[model samples]
Target chain A: MQPRLVRLTVWAAVLGLAACKPKEAPAPPRPDPADAAQRAAAAFVHCVEGGNAACIRTGLPHGAFDAFVLLGWLATGSPVAILDALSRELVAHSDPRTVQGRFVREVERLSGPLRGAECSPVGAQELAPMVTQLAQATKARLEAIGMASADMMRVVEGLAAEAAEGLEGAFLVRMSCKREPYQLYLAMVPEGPRYSAIGLMPYLPRFLGGDEAQIDAAQALRSKSLGISGAAAPVPDGTVDRYLPIPMEEF
Target chain B: MFASFASFLLAVSVGLSSGAPDPQARATAAGYEQLRGFATVLVTHLNRALGTEHLPPFVGAPVTPGLIVTADPSRVQLFDRFAVPLSAGRVSPPEPSPECASKCPKILFDTFRRWWFELGVESRTHAVEVPDVVLIGAHRDLPAQTLTQIAYAASESRPIQPPRLMLLTHGGPAGVRGIPFYLVRPGGLTLPPNSAALGLTVTIEPGRFVVTAAARSFGRTLSATSVPELVAILKDVHRHHPNKAAIVYRFSGDVSVGNFVATYAAVREEFPVAVLGDDEPITIP
Candidate 1:
């Protein structure tokens, strides 16, 4: 009887050990911040490549408007086929608070309709607080995404700031020169778009008679009158010619 | 006890081997490996070409350098062509130039205007006639009409814009074209503008349905008409492939024109331009 009882106990032990074989551990939980950042970046790249800016707002995190602005600059190359894809992805995941703040900040920076004189001052005043909130949200999202240390992100942001400033100066100059027949020539330079103060035909008497100093002064007044003080002066003809000669024959 | 131990061992072996992922998964993994190998080869070739040291061979075969003159003098006309004015504040004005700037007699502002209009018409006709392939070239001083003609050709018929590959034979102001142009240095030698004259060797194989451009003489400046003329000649060759095509162009005195003739003979046998996206064989409907 004692031997039989021992055998039974051994069988029970074996059964228990077989039952205890561990099941595969559940897939590790995704890190929320990393996942969100990756998704946002992927969605943004996709939309910009597809050439659909309108679709990018949806996939953005609750406060990441700056990322959307960055997308616009990066989407300039090639056919920009990915923009449409990104827009669809962003819009499907709409949480306005996630992206609105950054959007407004970027608009202000890009001189997007929000900052122009053509926009009513009353409307601007009303939207100021909302814009501020958007900026803060964007900053928070950037921090969350760990974009603070990214060199590429910083360069993109810097370029955006420069473009915004340039656009503002250009707008001012255009307003001041509105009465002149001089037409604006906006050249899309590699870094950003540049506006020539106004171009007049070389054969025209006024243009041919004017000395270099006179031409420079007119451009300066246009800049000052538009309240664009710190803008870079018009590039010298020699330099401009080397870099982008007026394809005069192929206008 | 022995029977139970054997059963347990058998079950573990079965799970380790037969219970592994399906054959389809294994095949997919193999397919991915092959894809990776092909990608590696492509990337390696591209890197070699772009590297700072030795220049890689041209992507396609070489062909005889050629030229075309629109013998039809009646086709020439003139109209307002777009031009960037000299004054800084001026808008681009409509200047008149020759319609056939490439083939027409050189004239000042008036004759040039008429030449531009003719060129625009020719460019449009080329696009319509050869919907599959159109090659264009512009001299350092491309007339405004030539640029507009290229733009017009690029805009016609394709839902999406077709790719434009460009090779700069001269350094000058950027000219407008329907397609994006790349600047290539010939003989792997990079030289500054005004230091060299250049010519492009193009071949079109209509039977094979392919077009190829080879960078021929370096350090030479070709006229704006040279590239368009070369393209027209290639199109003509495509029309008479598996037979013979004639090339006609005057060369600048600076370079050995004979070298171009020999190089084209050697290169023409290899490069042929085919329909876009038809690099591989397919059965025509």
Candidate 2:
């Protein structure tokens, strides 16, 4: 009876301890969608600014990257019908993963011009800060000239008016990199819960000659440099002028 | 001789330490030449940075004469264009200088008055032309018309269409504001076609149809208010235009890339013969 009574007391103690245990902390609240989107978008810019290839890839989803590349390629004067047909053929043989890899490589190549550049991801609403930067630049430049106070004010006022007029109705998310003449404006679009950036025009410089000729030549040269062959479409000159098309829905 | 040498050394040392202004710079600050001097200096710096022998001269397009708008958030002013006051503050005029010695301020005022007058006249006249290179002040809000006005003031001087119209915003990287380095113009364009080539102007607006016309040619006037309606008209023209006609785009700097890309894409779709007109080769940033 003593042994049995002792066992019963121990079981009661165990039950009391179990009942007294605190409830587990509630699951962390789901991240807000807007904040998530902003963070996701900014991460891409951060990676690019950091010049991290791996980080860039991680930020870029397959679909978003493809859409960007296709848009830029088609913009280079490729006839829609021709590209539509060529895109199908290119997609047939190319792997989406491999296409993304090449794109990251292309970004790595083009980022040379923008190396050490101060790039900022500007939202549609957050342009005031940048505008202020521009104002400072203007003031310093004008001040350096040693103009009269009134004259300087006049110039600054006019510029301020112009800036006001020009930016009134624009709604865009841009990654503006401070290059020589002002800044390089690259557009970004929201994809699902995140955002993706477009950066390709810097590859097609003007010195290569006429529009069609230059585009073809640059693409062919780019392809050769990348050792890309089977997938890229070859122009009449026996050089590949097109990149492998990764099929993405209209973005 | 030793005393004189010592004094000369002292002056040289003082000048070097103080970074004495050059004669040209000193002269540039005073008189009517100041306006022209500013232009020369700005252009020289732009050319040096651009690696080009000549970029079109900068024509200042201040909104008001004699008054300068600075980006001072403290004081706000209500312009005719805005209902709310702008954060850009005004510079108070200095003590009246009736007997002005430099004459630079007078010249600046006169030049600004003329530009403002011309701009008003141009707007009233509904001139469709844009300038080759316009330098709007270094403010952040690029309202559609301001940066584009850079070329209009210049257009008053040179009526001819330049090979390229480069629309840029002021304020560049630190210490380079005087030089207009921010290029705001759209890119990926072919060289300007011959003057004789037929041209049509297409204005870009987001998610809306645009009506455009061939203002360059009389009797070739075509109209459609929306982009789709205009695209239909251009399709007919492209199908039949004997000479490969070129399409010139006229838009405020505020036009989005999506709108532009869509418009360009639509034009490219119909005009497989390719009659797009622009001054420079595709020199995008």
Candidate 3:
């Protein structure tokens, strides 16, 4: 009986040893760098195309403004191809009387000389006179309205600031008037980053109806939406349709 | 045999007790609770507007209540079909006009803004505000004397050498408009313009100097600096301006690289500076 008990104890010991031994963990599948990169790129493209704000927030590198701009373009349907085509077309046939013309003239002056001489060369002597005339005309128009010189100066300074940045390359002149609404399109350029800003676009309601009150209201809304001063007020629920209103007013 | 059964029961109890709440589940629950509260408020408002009977208090939080309205067209259609008839007597269904089409949207937007403001205030009360830094970059080379004057005026500790300079310039002969140039110095030095190249340089003192130039013009006369040396210079700058909140500079229009540099600067506890155009002084945090 003692011998039988010893054999049972030995069998128990062997079982315990077997249980205690570490099992080999399945080797982790090696990550494919190419696949990972492809996934990342796909996610980025999807976020840009889908215009899903949550997906954009998740896919973008944190605090990246480029991602924000790209998302904004996607949301507005102002992709790179559209923006570039618009810019080139505007540049080609822009008449000086229109807002696009004024911007094109300004860009031409600032950029020194475009490689192709599609238009007559603006001489150094003519440049200052033209700028002075434009400035004077702008001042007169502002005076005709209630806007103070300070406000006009602020607008001019803001536009100049934007031009100094590389934004001129990416954005096309949409429309701008001294007292009217200003709009710029982010042209779809094949190279580099692109974004469009419809500055004072929401306020076009005022220009449409000639209602100063509506314009003021729209301006306030634009400022809050753009988060110009600080953090933009969060988009209110059920107000998405307000951004793209049917144009009722004629130029 | 009874004791062995009791021991097994005890072991199962212990195993069950050891399980912890899943963090993801907890977060989802919290999110759902917030969504439910928002939905309740929204539904309550709609009910009041429609003069419908109030809904009973929900037993538990609702998940994706909007989905219910979307998935069930009949529910939304019922509201839409009834809205005109219900309001027809009290509020005359005004003739559709182009003006109304434009103005109606604004009224809706105003309501949304009000709701958003209330939500934001509520969130803010619960949210923890964290300190953050903003970094600005500029291609223009700043004068050492100007920096010294500002440093003296501010009464901040001055470093022995100038901070490493980062220059943004056009990339090459191809004339790529926006390319960033990074220059580093182990010991700080003032930047001086490269007379022969399309760059600016400043000499802080003997053996201390800083230079910025365009990439197309970055050969022969222009001296190159290492990345480690630039990091060391930044570290020295951090040492001197220990108390300042942010460091702002002008970016060369390269947001990605610029943000990275800004983050690096912020990590050192210096506030990133907003780079305004020429003549605008770098706003020290």
Query: Which number leads on TM-score?
Result: 2
After superposing candidate 1, which stretches have Cα over 4 Å from the reference?
A: A1-84, A87-93, A110-251, B1-148, B151-285
Q: What is the TM-score (0 to 1) of candidate 1? A: 0.21
Tell me the lDDT of model 1 at A216.
Answer: 29
DockQ of candidate 1 is: 0.02
Instruction: Name the regions of candidate 3 deviating beyond 4 angstroms.
Output: A1-251, B1-227, B253-279, B282-285
lDDT per residue (tens digit) for residues A26-93 in model 3:
99896543333233333322333343333222211111112222222212211112111222222221
Residue lDDT tens for model 1, B73-151: 1121111112222222111333422332222122223322222222222222111111212223222222323322332
The numbered model that scores best in lDDT is: 2
C-alpha DockQ of every model: 0.02, 0.01, 0.01
Task: Flag the better candidate by TM-score, 1 or 2.
Answer: 2
Candidate 2 chain B, poorest ten consecutive residues by summed lDDT: B75-84
The C-alpha lDDT values of all candidates are 0.26, 0.34, 0.25
Over B5-110, each residue of candidate 2 has an lDDT whose tens digit, in order, gives 2243344333322432444673475411222223433333334233112111223122111111121112211111111122222222322123222121222232
Give the per-residue lDDT digits (tens) of candidate 3, residues B136-187. Answer: 1111222222222111111111111111122122223322121111221111
Once model 1 is optimally superposed onto the true structure by TM-score, how far is the C-alpha of residue A34 displaced, in angstroms?
A: 45
lDDT rank, highest first? 2, 1, 3
List the per-model TM-score of the A chain.
0.21, 0.35, 0.22
